[model samples]
Target: MIRLIWTLSAHTRYYLRRYMPTNRLLDEIRRRRNLKWGIPAMLLAVPYLLIASICTNALDQGAPGWLHLVVLWSVWNAMKLIIMGPVSLLLLVRARIAEAVARRGGRRDSDAGESVNHAGAEPLLHR
Candidate 1:
């Protein structure tokens, strides 16, 4: 059992390392992007939350309003998990691609001896 658990853990770690952002800053940006999506998601849920609260309170008079609230909360959390995971992942992948492109462009520019700051202009030589 321990061996199996260890193997699974190692595999999961490897997978995450391969797929997730390698740089610390990029990882942080991914987390912040998730939070940015999450905060507005919770804000948008306010109306449904109010509805659930009303239902729960109304059930105090003797009904099953708690059921509605339970379902609402469950679905809301599930949807958030489902939606945010891919969106944040997409952002991280995009950042990685952009970084790769910039690195490639930087190498090409340096090799060609050109500065993007001055396009098609004469080279400046200091004596």
Candidate 2:
């Protein structure tokens, strides 16, 4: 019974987190192909920061203490997005470099094979 309760609670938490506004927004951004959308996604942090600012202002204006949670959540989401942008850019650069290297390597290998075949050598397949 205890194990079942724990499992259910874990599942509930996962679904809750998955559907959170910030997570949903990030999921949408990452759904695009090739991580190309990530560059623009960096701009999303601005709205989160603005939300935090607004909540903070509300708190100062004698709003409910619950607004503190909103401010913290907004700031956390903003920081996540800010950090994701630079990390995604680095990943994109690394991918491009690897692709370029692979292309050059493939071409060099093909050229070397052609030269060997033209040097009057028996084809490896027939041998």
Candidate 3:
């Protein structure tokens, strides 16, 4: 049972080393890409605002009470978008930070060609 557990743990570590992204990729992408909160902010806000404006215009046409209700719905949706957009953007930023940290750690591990062990001992493995 102990051997099985050890083998599984070793395999997991090996696969993690083989597949994870290196720090170089993370650094290059982070440097090249501007994380634009404005783009996402506009994306989240603009469509709903446009729809709300159109609905308001339609309501002004004096069509019916149902159309007024539609306008109200549009306004509510717009408000929801405006409120949630920032929250979503914050979540996205956090996700990127986490990804960067993982990539950096993985790259360091790969460069050292040493798995971080519980006992802080470096073991040379045959690749």
In the range 2-121, model 3's lDDT, one tens digit per residue, is 999999999988885566443222222233243344234435456656776777777678656676676676566556545544554565687789999999999998866545554576
lDDT of model 2 at position 120? 95
lDDT of 2 by residue, 1-127 (tens): 9999999999998996698876676666554354676767778889989999999999999999999998998899888788777777777777788889999999999999999999999888999
Better of 1 and 3 by TM-score: 3
Q: Model 1 Cα displacement at 15 (Å)?
A: 37
User: What lDDT does each candidate get?
Assistant: 0.59, 0.82, 0.59
- The per-candidate count of clashes, in order, stands at 0, 0, 0
* Residues 2-63, model 1: lDDT tens digits: 99999999998888656743223234435634434533443444565566666676677677
Best by TM-score: 2
Error of 2 at 37 (Å): 2.4
> Between prediction 2 and prediction 3, which has the larger TM-score?
2
How high is each candidate's TM-score?
0.39, 0.73, 0.43
Task: Give me candidate 3's TM-score against the actual structure.
Answer: 0.43
- For residue 94, what is the lDDT in candidate 2? 79
Clashing pairs in 2: none
